[model samples]
Target chain A: NAGVTQTPKFRVLKTGQSMTLLCAQDMNHEYMYWYRQDPGMGLRLIHYSVGEGTTAKGEVPDGYNVSRLKKQNFLLGLESAAPSQTSVYFCASRLDRRVYNEQFFGPGTRLTVL
Target chain B: EDQVTQSPEALRLQEGESSSLNCSYTVSGLRGLFWYRQDPGKGPEFLFTLYSAGEEKEKERLKATLTKKESFLHITAPKPEDSATYLCAGRYNNNDMRFGAGTRLTVKP
Candidate 1:
């Protein structure tokens, strides 16, 4: 089972341009999360969803929005891309992400803002 | 502020050599400690999970141990396949999981 998958393995955007990242999971997970990793910085959560129709902001949510329309998909949107938004983005899923659930991560999407 | 830090940003060991990596963390509440192995340009792969102090888990050449304030990943006679960035993360009871910058390890022949 392709535990988790992300669309557009790589992307390049111009300042002010808008884009959305798609994350899909086939494990029927109860939780999904979006995080960004920058050089010298650890992965920081941008947003997360506990279930379909429920979304919450995480550690770093500025410049981003998320939607969980389907139980199998989570989308991260950038309204106006900036250089600061350029980083490697990762998506993760967990069957029960309540307290100590172990997360399964996708391959990751590398973004570059020019 | 919740934080996770890993020591010896990077380590190089001869094949068959043994070593250990350190991870220290601070959070509102500790629920679990996670260890992952990440190859360059790839996503992290889960290794072991320690739920509380005195908890330990082992896989092949890796053994993970947890304590109140820190965790250690011990590698015994590691092979080149063990060369990767080791990441330590913590999950709080509230479901907030934070990661460390990662300690890169290189097992040479």
Candidate 2:
């Protein structure tokens, strides 16, 4: 089912440049999340959507923005990229909170800000 | 604040050696704890989920056990194919999930 897929497996950006990462899922999940994984820091949530048209800040939401206009897609945008923003970003989706909590993760996008 | 911590950032084992990885969490209203295996440059693969204390799940040569405060992933007779970073996460407040830094395991033949 290609549970979840992310666009642009790898990218390099200059400081101040902006870009958006796209996440798509075909599982009809009701929850979507964006997280950054830094070495030794684990995965830190940047933003999440409980459902279409709803977005919320997470543990590390600064320097990132997100949108979930459709049920199957979630997007994470960087207004001004910085060296500190360079990391591996992952997208995940869950079927439902009450019914199941296991998250299905995408391959991940590796970003490098120069 | 919710936190999930794993011990022994890295480990090396010989073939047939058995070991256990640890995951401790501090989160209010814990809903579930999860285990995942991730190979380099790839996404995490779900392993097991523990919903409550005293729960245990097994897959192949790996076993996951959960308690009120922590979880353990025990691997038996490790092989090179089992080499990867193992991660654990705790879900709470329904939507909040916190992941550990992960424990990298290397099994050498």
Candidate 3:
């Protein structure tokens, strides 16, 4: 299984330009999440979905939007890319919300907003 | 606020050296603590999960132990292949998972 796969391994964006990072998981997970990792910082959740058609805000949801129209896909969109948004983005999925359930992560997408 | 802090920002050890990485966390309601290993230019890979205090889990040369307020990942006889940033995360009752800055370990032969 692919587990989780993210599109556009790397990208360079000009400020104010918009782009969407796509994430797909073949694990049939019930929970999917989008997180950003900045240098010297831990991963911060931007948005997540418990299931298809259900999206919720996360710790750093501002300036970002997400859609989970299908169970296997979660897309993160940056309406207007900013320098602050230049970071490594990761997508993860898990089978359930149980405390013991482990998350599987994708390779990650590196975004550089100049 | 929920937060996680990892110690010794970075560490370099000899091939046979043994060491432990610490992860301290605070959350309104603890659900679980997780450990992951991330290689350069790749995403984090799951290692273990501790659901409650006193719980322990192990994989190959790594062992994870959890306590009331912290978790420790013990690396035994680590090899160069084990070199990477180790991350710890805590899941709360609200379903939010907070991660630590991570401990970078470099095992040199």
TM-score, per-candidate, Cα-based: 0.97, 0.97, 0.97
Scoring each candidate complex against the real one, what DockQ results? 0.73, 0.75, 0.79
Q: Give the per-residue lDDT digits (tens) of candidate 2, residues B1-109.
A: 7889999899999999999999999856778898999999998999999988899999998999998899999999999999999999988877868899999999999
Docking class of 2: medium
lDDT of 3: 0.92
Model 2 lDDT tens row, A19-39: 999999999999999999999
Tens-digit lDDT string for candidate 1 (A31-62): 99999999877899999999999999999999
Task: Compute the DockQ of candidate 3.
Answer: 0.79
Q: Write the per-residue lDDT of candidate 3 for residues B8-48, one digit (tens) a residue.
A: 89999999899999999994587889899999999999899
For residue A81, model 1's alpha carbon misses the true position, in angstroms, by 0.4
lDDT of each: 0.92, 0.94, 0.92
Where model 2 places Cα greater than 4 Å from the true spot, the runs are none
Return the DockQ of model 2: 0.75
- Residue pairs that clash (backbone atoms under 3 angstroms), model 2: none
Q: Evaluate model 1: give its TM-score.
A: 0.97
